[model samples]
Each structure stands twice: as C-alpha cells, then as structure tokens.
Target: MTLALHRHGPDGVPLVLLHGFPLDARMWDDVVAELPGLPVVTVDAPGFGASPRPDDVARAVGRSAEPALETYADAVAAALHEAGVDRAVVAGLSMGGYAVLALAERHRGLLAGVGLLDTKATADDDAARANRLTVAAAAESAGAAAVAPMLTQVLGATTQAERPEVVERMRSWLAAAPPVGIAWAQRAMAARPDRLFTLEDLAVPALVLRGAEDGSAPQEAASTMSAALTDAEVVVVPRAGHMSAVEAPGPVAAALRGLYERCAQGSVG
Candidate 1:
C-alpha cells in the first residue's frame, strides 16, 4: 500500500483529499490554494498519479491486490499513518467519494469529518456496472483515449460553453491518466457495494456538495447522502458540473473550510 501522499501546512488534523477517477491530487490545486492557512493532505489513488496500480506488484510496495475501494481506503489509512496523522477530515469527489465511504466503513476511527462531493452512496446499477466494465475493457486496449468521451459528462454545460480553459484542462487530465489506472478504477467502481449505511453511523460532521448543473451526480443523490448523514450540510455550487471543485473552487473551498473548522473545534460528533 504505497499510495503517494502530499501533506500541506505545519500542524493540525489535515483535511485529507481524494481525487475523482482519471484525475490525480492535482485536481485539488485550485481548491487547496483557496484554503489559505488550513492544513491539507492530498493522496493519489492507487494506479493514479504517482501511486502504483493494485496489480502493479513491482510498485505495490506492500499489501494484497484487488479492484476494491476498501483496498484504496486501506492504502489511504496507511499513507496517513506513515505521515503521523491518526485522524483527519477526509473528503472526496466523484469516484473519490466512493473511497471516502469505504474509509468510513473500514477505518471509522480515522475520520474527524466526512465530505461527499458530486458522488453517490449507492452501488452501480446493472447497466452502470456493465458500462463501467465495458469502458474498462476498452481503456485497457485503447489507452486513455477510451475515456476521452467522458469529458462531456464530467464538466457542466456552462463550463463547456464558457470556460474553454477548464474543459481543455480536464481534457488534458483525462488524456494523461494511465491506461491501467483508468481501467482499474472503472472496474473497482463498478464492483463497489452500497455504502449509505456507512454514513448512518459515521457520527461525524458531514458535507454533501453538488454542482447545480451536475448531470452525473444529481440533486437526488446529494439529498440521499445528506439524509443518511446525521450531521450534514448540503451545498450546491452554481454553474458547476460534476467537477465542482475545479469548476468553482471558491465555493467548494469555502464549504470544505467550514467542515474543517467544525472538525477542528471538536464541537460536533
């Protein structure tokens, strides 16, 4: 479990961030900059960024191999432990959100707070699962280009039409994703189990964020997650899509900063 971890700030329980599929810790650069003095830690998912693929034993460093978010969560916990952090306000967006739940389910003691952004707590439906597997297979053969079509579904209409830079930026990230990582992440996500119950017992402050224009993770999903969380605040970023943090860093960062402060005060469960 040698997931790459990048820590920021000098002390305090850092806000640990997980990136969405096909992207790396760099996705949070804008949002992290907006965070000012807050402590932060960003880790690349297995097979993404500087981390090794689950099956890339030559670089796996340690632990078993599987296309499971539990594996990703374990790697995350291990990375943080190595960094001397026993607890943190962990947050994730899209695919990253899936791992966040896995962490909550498996390493509940490590969480100071939980943030779910542009993601759902349910397992992929039959069609969704099939599509993911198909894409994974295609990506393995065609490389990152196989996921390029997802660019349309990732950014909001407003962003695609107005923020050409952001769309192009997302395109580059998608294009730069490792083919093996892309395929592995798709399969892992497809095989995930329903995790709504995990949040029901989280007993930590939660933030459910969605993009007002997000087509992938709609308002319904956000509501379902908020409903499951005992202490949750739902925030919708306007003119943003599935990549809300990148599309609207100010709002996303503000929401995260609030969650961080709550966890820091140790005022909430």
Candidate 2:
C-alpha cells in the first residue's frame, strides 16, 4: 500500500515518525514545530487518517509470521528510501513505538537511533488483548465517532479537562477514520509479539519517553524498557498524558535533539 507521507524540513538528520492507532500523521503537528528546519518524515498508518483502508484489516497489518509491526516498519523504510534517506532516527508514539522497535529488530541497518514515546515493548496481557478485541468490536459496530471521545478522555491529562477544542480535534480525527481501519489496527496490536525479546540485542542508541501522567505507558513500563536497553535513556515528561509530544513539546523536542545530535556527532552510536 502507498502510505500518505508528510515531510518537514529540507535538510538535517533523517527522522521517520509513526503515529499511534486511531490517529494519523497530523498528530505530530505540534512536535513538528520544534523540529523546524530538520528533515523529518511522518506517515499515516494504513487504514488510518489519510491513508487508504485495507480490504482485509487483519491481512493488511500482517496475519502472517512477520506480524503487523514488520509491515508497518517496512512501510516507513520504503518511505525513507523513496525520500533518499538511507538512515534515520526513527521515533513513534504508542502503536508507533511498537513499530519503531520492530524496525530496530528487523531493519536495524536502516536506523541511526530510535525514540519510543508513550509506548511499551511488552506483549499485551490476555486481559489487555481481550479488552482490545472488545474495543475493536465496538469500533466496528458503533463507529469511530462513538469511540473517539472515550479515547480523548483516556489519552488526555487533567489539564485537558477545560480544553474542549483539544477533545474536539481528537474526536474529529478519530471520527474521520474508517471503522475497519481502527478495528484492524486494534486486532493487529493485540496480536503483536513480545518485543522485549529483541531489546537486549539492540545496538543503537534509544530513548524511552513516557508521559508523567500516561496511564497506558506508565513509569513502571518505562523503567522496565530502560533496564532492557543497555544504551537507552529514559525521559519522563511531566504534566503530559499519552500525547507527550502534543502536551509537552519543549521537553520532548529537547530529548529528540539531544539524541539526534549525539548520534550525528558520533558520540553515541
């Protein structure tokens, strides 16, 4: 599938950004400003945002041995190749974080570094997977509009309580997504293999950024990932929820800049 991509900056270290499920490349808009004048590539996931929906959601992500993360990673790799980026600092949020780790494992040669934002590397517990399946069913039946508000509430920090516009924007983004796409992503995520097995073998610099207020990727999960990655650093952005880039752009950007610059300068690679 030809994924829709948005490029920012004309020159700099290559960065491939993957968005979470139920949202698309546009979710990175707030973070993009901090990366002004730096080459970054952001793509909409298959069946999400501006990307085309797959005829069969399960098969689209990867019902095969490779799993969905591999397909999503390859898509980003292809996007980078098409953009003439031989190597990049790949970053992803939530579902995107899983994709980033998948890339690190399957295509390490194509990446200079990795940023896992508000995501976990562990496989979903049975209860979590079952819950996701339930969510997928609801999304398939009730539609994106119905689930969007609930998502906003779950993803936002307490500060977002008064931000009707933020919630509305999230709603509009989710509502615009095809129900099949959301459901398919949910299933794919639930079925994703445990990536913890691959972390101990990592050879690249890594950043594990979690929202201080993020319930999905709590501090404990971040600590576990940091412990697994020998060369990884952890950054906890205060006052943010799942959307750290949107909630605390400055700190997130600082972390990105530090990692990318260190890699570029050949200090950590």
Candidate 3:
C-alpha cells in the first residue's frame, strides 16, 4: 500500500506519526512545527489524502485480504523501508493508536519508542463494535457527512465550548472525508482484537497520554497501557479530548519531542 509519507527536518531518529480516523497526515502539521530539528514523518493512512485505497494497493491488488489494521501497518512499514528508515519512534491518536499497536505487533523491530495518545489497547465492546458498524453503513450509504455528528463526541467539552473554531475545522474535515475510506477504517477498527498483550513484551520506552477531559479514551485506558508497557509514563493533557494533539498541540508536541529525544539517544537503541 505504500501510504503517502511526508518528511520534515534532517536530524534525530525519525518520529513517525499516524492520524486518527478520517483525518490525514496534515493533522500533524502543527505538532511537527513545534519540533524544530527533530526529524518527523507523517503518514496518511490507506485511502486518505493522496494514498490509494486498500483494494487498489499493490499487496491487496489481487483477491484482497479482509479489512485489518495489520494490513495498514504492513503498508506503513513498506513506506518506511522505501524512505530508508529502518527504525523510528512511532505514535498515533485514536484509530491511529490502533494502527500503531498493529505495527508494534507486526514490525516490532522498526520501533524505537511508542506514543499512544487518547487511545486504548482493548478491543471494542459489543456496543462500540455495533456503533462502528452502524457508522460504517451510514458512511457507505450517506457519505462522510454521516460522521459529522461525531464531532461532539470526538472533541472535549472544553474544546467544544471554548474553541468553536477547532470544532468547525473538524466538522469541515469530517464533511470532506471519503465515504469508502470511512467505511473501510470503521469496519477495520470494529474487527480489531484486544491488544493489551502487545504492550506486555514491549521493553522499549513508551509514552501514554490522554486528555483529562477525553470521554472517548479515558485516563483508565492510558493507565492500563502504561501498566502493561515495561518502560512507560502516562501524561494527562489538560482541557483536551480525544484529539489531544489537535486540541492542545503544545503539550502533545512536547511529550512527543521528549519521547523522540529519549529513543534517539546514544544508549537507547
């Protein structure tokens, strides 16, 4: 699938970032801007931005495999290999976090560190799974605008009440999202397995963060992940929500910068 990759800066171990559902690599622009010389690689997930849809990718060109985040991870690894990056600090938010975990499972050798922000290691409960399927059906039937109602749930109460502009921006993104991409991602996420075990053997440094006001990805979820990881710390971002990196880029950027510096150090890898 060789997802689209955008590189920034020329120093340090490359910090790879994955975006949440329906959003593309552009979501990381602000966070990347905050890190001056730290090399950064932002990837647009399958079917998002300029990348080809899953069924159109080289690996999936034939009778394609079922929708799975692991496929996306393989594409991510391929893209990195194409860019000549053998190792990197990988991070993600929401659905991106799910993909990050998939990559950790399938391509652990490529990870220097991991940042799990506003995400959980558990699989979706029956309710959540049904909701995802419902949303997928809606996206396929009505288009990306079907996810527009999710804006309130995705953003924090603080962001919704105090930063209407951010909410508006997200709304626009949602409206413009591709229906096929939305359906594929939603179904993939719904079928994902519980991945807390993925963190159990991860001896590498890890940063688990969640917005204090995040309803979607609770602090308990971050705690569970941090407890599973061998070497990890949890950071609670104030006044942010599921989209912490977007709601409050400063703290998210700082946390990511610290993680990159730690993993890029002479003694780590």
Candidate 4:
C-alpha cells in the first residue's frame, strides 16, 4: 500500500522527515514550521498515522524474508517518486532512523543526505530483543494503551516533570496508535540488522543528533555514528530526550536547515 505523505515547501532538495515508532507525521509539526519555505516531506510509515496497516503493507511489498525496515524504505522511495522528488535528504528519529539506514542500504541513489536523530546503528542485544518481543506481545494482547508506560522511559526527566502538555500530546499519540502497528514495529525493530557498516560506508553528508538526556540513543551512540560517517556533524540538544525534535524544535530545526543547505548546494552525495 502507498504510504501517506505530507508535503510542504517547494523548489529545493527535498527533506524527508520520518517519525519514530508509534508516532506519525504530526511529530514533525513544530520542526516543519521552523523550516519555513524549505522543501519537506513527512511520511507515515506503514501501519502508522494515515498509512495502511501491517497486513496491507505486507501484501503491497509482496512476501519476503526481508525485514520490515526495508519495506518501509521502499514505501518512502515510492512516495517521493510520486511527489516528483528524485532524490532527498532523508531524516528520521529512532525507528525512523532505522528505516533511513535501510533506505541508504537498498536505495542509495535516492539519498542526498541523512539525518539520524535519537537513534543508533547497532542492532538490538539479546535482552533488548527479548524486551521488544515482550512489549509486542503485550501490545497485541492488551492494545496500544498497554504501551502507555513507555512515556516515562522515552521522555526526558524535565519533559516529564514540566511539559505536561507535551507529555499529554505524546500519550494521546501512543494511546491512539494501532495495536497491530505497535506490535509489528516492535518485532521489526527487534529483528533489525546492525547497520554500523552502512554508516562507515556513507558517502552522503550526514547529521547525527540526539537529546543530551536521551536514554534510548545516548550521546555515545551519536558520537559513534558521527565517527563512522565520512562527513557528519553531531548535535546534542540539551534538556531533551528521545523525542528531541519535539523537546527542542529550535535546535533540531537549525540543524536540519544546515543539512538542507548542504544538500542543496550539491555538497552532499
């Protein structure tokens, strides 16, 4: 199934924003607002936001032993083609980052640059994989609401303590997420391949960003990824967490603007 695409701006190297698991295109609302006239495309990966669910997605891509991340990358590539964008600077947060890496691996020619935000290149460890599977089972059996407790772990301490509105907004998104989508994402993430080699071989300009307080993708992970990329800039947003784009839109937008300009100037691969 064709994923839903939210288009913005025009006439430049396209900036494709991919949101993290259980969230949708709306997660980029504030950052997009800050970007103003820069060309941007935010996508709802399969089973999230306005896009088709996992069953439809599985059918659309046909049966395969490939991980779902590759399927997601293909959907994004198709969406861009339909939008008349031949190449784009792809940026993603968390699960979105995994998809971006997958895109780089399978559809390298379509990328102009990459933004890895609050994510890592390492595959899940055994314990982490088991935990993800457990979460998937819980989400399947009890619905999306069963994953609400993740808010505490995903957000920064400051966001949890002071940003009631942000917390509520995130909660709403998580609560409304499809159970099937959550389960599918968890399983896919658990099974994701380690892509550190992809980063090491990257030819395009890349940005590695993370919230200073991000537990999911720590500062060390950002540094490691930055070290791997041939050309990369690292940005750590203070007072933020896993959802740095939401927690610190100003810094995230500024960083994105820099990446966009680099891509537009033909400096990026």
Give the top-scoring candidate (lDDT): 1
Clashes of 2: 0
Candidate 3 colliding pairs = none
Collision pairs in model 1: none
TM-score of 3: 0.96
State each model's CA lDDT, in order: 0.89, 0.76, 0.88, 0.87
If scored against the real structure, what TM-score would every candidate get?
0.96, 0.89, 0.96, 0.95
* Residue-wise C-alpha lDDT for candidate 3, range 1-269, written one tens digit per residue: 46889889985568999999889888888899998888899998888998888776536433265778888888888888888888889999999999999988999999999999999999999999999999999988899877988899889999999998899989998889988789889989999999999999998889999999999998789889999998897899999988999899999999998887778663434
Model 3 steric clash total = 0
Q: Of the candidates numbered 3 and 4, which has the greater lDDT value?
A: 3
- How many clashes (backbone N, Cα, C below 3 Å) per candidate? 0, 0, 0, 0
Task: List where candidate 3 sits over 4 angstroms from the true fold.
Answer: 58-63, 266-269
What lDDT is reached at residue 88 by model 1?
Answer: 88
- Candidate 2, pairs of clashing residues: none
Q: Any residue pairs clashing in model 4, and if so which? A: none
lDDT of 2 by residue, 1-269 (tens): 44677888877657778887778888888788897767778888777766665433235444453226566676667656766677888889999998888887888888788888999988999999998888888887888754565555445565377556666776677678678777777877888888886778777788899888898888888888888886788898887788777667778888887778767766332
* TM-score, predicted candidate 1 vs. hidden true structure: 0.96
**For residues 11-64, could you state the per-residue lDDT of candidate 4 as single tens digits?**
666799999888899999999999998888899988888998766766676646
Stretches of candidate 2 exceeding 4 Å from the true structure: 55-67, 267-269
Candidate 4 local Cα displacement, residue 102, angstroms: 0.4
